[model samples]
Target: MSEPILSLEAVETDIAQYHILKGVSLSVPRGQVTMLLGRNGVGKTTTMRTIMGLLRNKAGQIRFDGAEISGELASSRCRAGIGFVPEDMGIFSALTVEENMILAAVSGAPDRARLDWLFTVFPPLKTFWKAPAGTLSGGQKQMLSIARAMIEDRKLYLIDEPTKGLAPAIVSTMVGALRELKRQGASILMVEQNFAVARALGDHCVVMDDGRATWSGAMADLATDHALQERLMGLSMEAG
Candidate 1:
């Protein structure tokens, strides 16, 4: 296996008075997808936020590309090539699709070639290019959100639930786009509740429970072991 592009060791985070992530540790191998899996309210999203530098770690270290980034601001992290597609699909509702894409680029304008390719990858983005983001359907919003993070080439992408609450057809489209990214050798840390999606996309898996990383290994191993799946994620591939 290649060296990890990102690693969190003994990391902890607290939300005001409540301790959230406690001693979480995991690794994302370079150019591979690492799935962050857990039931809801298990601090899965919190762990993603912490890695993206949104929630400051109260203790331990967060290292990106072998460098410690624990004290860096979120913007600095973004500038360092970490793209985040938050769980809420953090697009500005009032902005047009064009505007959202433009804003995602650090230079204030997306590269023309990449923009064209993105439009192909997500045709609806081109169809509704001038439409306000708020007017888009849920699936379109998700496409826009993913496109924004992908507007520029990123070293590592922190994605939270790309398949959540979407129709199966839409989910498949999302899956196809993500698979393309994987082919391009993008390193991704994604939080997914959909086991099928996770199994399909994840190269490595990190199972979290109660703000702690409880397991880390190959996705294939977890996928084939129904007993392990039930113990960690509470479902086997057949049921998931």
Candidate 2:
């Protein structure tokens, strides 16, 4: 395979006295959604934070678009074409939906063609274009968060816990929207806890546990291996 759009090798991070990530390494191939999956507290979110430079890495290398990004500031990373949709969806409650989208807008005027594309992929965003982000439902907020990231024209996107509290129907819409982004040549490294959605959207799967990558393989292989899923996620096929 060609070099990944994003790659982390032996990334380690410490919070206070606690070591959250223990040499975790993974890569997101260009134009694919590489799902990071595991049980809660498995360092999935930490991995995303580390990639975004929110949490400084104590060890290892992080490369974006073929250059080392471990020491880069968060703002520098953003300018270098890395967008994030945090677990909280980080929308400004006081801002209107359009304002929220505009806040993340890059140099060029918001891409009208891209906005139209987003409207087609995420219908709720189109319906709530005029609504305040805070007034919108949880799913709507997630949709807006995603739209903001897409507008950045980033080479890679790190989305954490995208479906945390959204409705089932909305989750389906989000998955479809991500697939559309992938088709448009954006590389996504998403942290997803929902098995069905992950399996459906991910081209590759990486399982993290206690701050380390425990398993990784093609999504197709992961779908067939019940034992692997059970070992990493603490869930069985019968329950899944």
Candidate 3:
């Protein structure tokens, strides 16, 4: 296997008095989607935040593109080619969709070619170009969040629980957009609760429990192993 583009080695993080991530370690290979899976309260989001520098790690090292970024500020990391889509979608409620996308662009305006492609990927973004982001439906907000991250070229994307609470049809649209992202060679480390979406987009998998990785392998392996899924995730594929 090739070297990972992003790596976390024994990363430890705490929130106030609570220890959320304990010795978390994982790798995101170049040009592939690596799914981070876990039940609620299992530190999956914490791990993503640590990578983004939203939460500082109390211990261990974070390496991106072969350099240590453990102490880098979130802005610095973002400038160095890391994009983040937080769990809450992070769109400016008061801003128009066009304004949000414009702000996300590094050059103060989105590149026409890329913006056109993004519109193709999520058509509603084009339809609601002038609408306030707060007025968009939940699924549309999620699409806007992802579209914002794609406004610029990035080495990796750290997305948290993108499919949460979406209707099945909307989830399917999200799955299609993500699949297109993969084809376009975007490296992603995503925390997703929806197994079907995970299985569709994940090239590799990391299963977390109680703030640590309990299993790691190809998504294909995890997808077929109902027994292993039950052991690591506390539910079978059928139940998922």
Candidate 4:
């Protein structure tokens, strides 16, 4: 197995006097998609925020690329090659799709090859290149969000709920795009509510509950163990 590109050891985070994470720990292996799975309000989003330094961990360590970054700023973490796509998608709604892509480019000018590749993955972005991001559909907005993150190369991507509220066709498109990204050696730590998408993309899995890791194993193991799914996520795959 590849070494972890990101690792958290006994991480804890509190939000405005409310404890959101209590001793959360997990490893995102290099070049693999690690799915963070759990029921609602189980600290999955909080964990992602803590990893990106959007929320600071009150205790324990966060290591990225073999260096300790528990005290680093969020901007510093971004410069260190961590890309984040929040649950809200975080696009500038008033901006044109092209403008959003431009801003996401680290050098202020996107590489042509990478841009072309993204256009291939999401054709709607190319079609609506000049349209306001707010004018696009929900799925299109999600595509734009992912495209922005991919505009620049990064060591890892932290994506939250890419398929939420999307149509099945759009979800299929996202699955294809993400699969291609994995094929191109992108390492991703994604929190997805869509079990089908999670099953399709995840190489490893971490189940969180009440702000702590309740289980960790290969995706294949979790997929086959129906009882485990019920125990961790409160629903079996068939019922979910």
User: Relative to the true structure, how large is the alpha-carbon lDDT of every model?
Assistant: 0.93, 0.86, 0.92, 0.93
Residues forming the 10-long window of minimal summed lDDT in candidate 4: 231-240
RMSD of 2: 1.4
Runs with alpha carbons beyond 4 Å of true place in candidate 4: none
lDDT score at residue 29, model 4, on the 0-100 scale = 93
Total residue pair clashes for candidate 4: 0
Q: Candidate 4: what lDDT? A: 0.93
lDDT of 1 by residue, 142-236 (tens): 99999999999999999999989999999999999999999999999999988899989999999998889999999999999999988987777
Summarize candidate 2's per-residue lDDT along 1-240 as a digit string, tens digits. 789998889999998999999899888888888889888887888889889989999999999999999999998999899999999898997888888878888666788887888889888777877787889888888899998998857888999988887888998888888887877788889888777878778888888888999888898788788887777777864454
Candidates' TM-scores?
0.98, 0.95, 0.98, 0.97
lDDT of 3 by residue, 1-240 (tens): 778999999999999999998899889999999999988999999999999999999999999999999999998999899999999999999999999999988656789999999999899999999999999999999999999998998999998998999999889888898898899899999999888888889999999999998889999999999999888988976756
Predicted structure 1: clash tally: 0
Poorest 10 consecutive residues of model 3 by lDDT?
A: 231-240
Name the lDDT value of residue 113 in candidate 2: 84
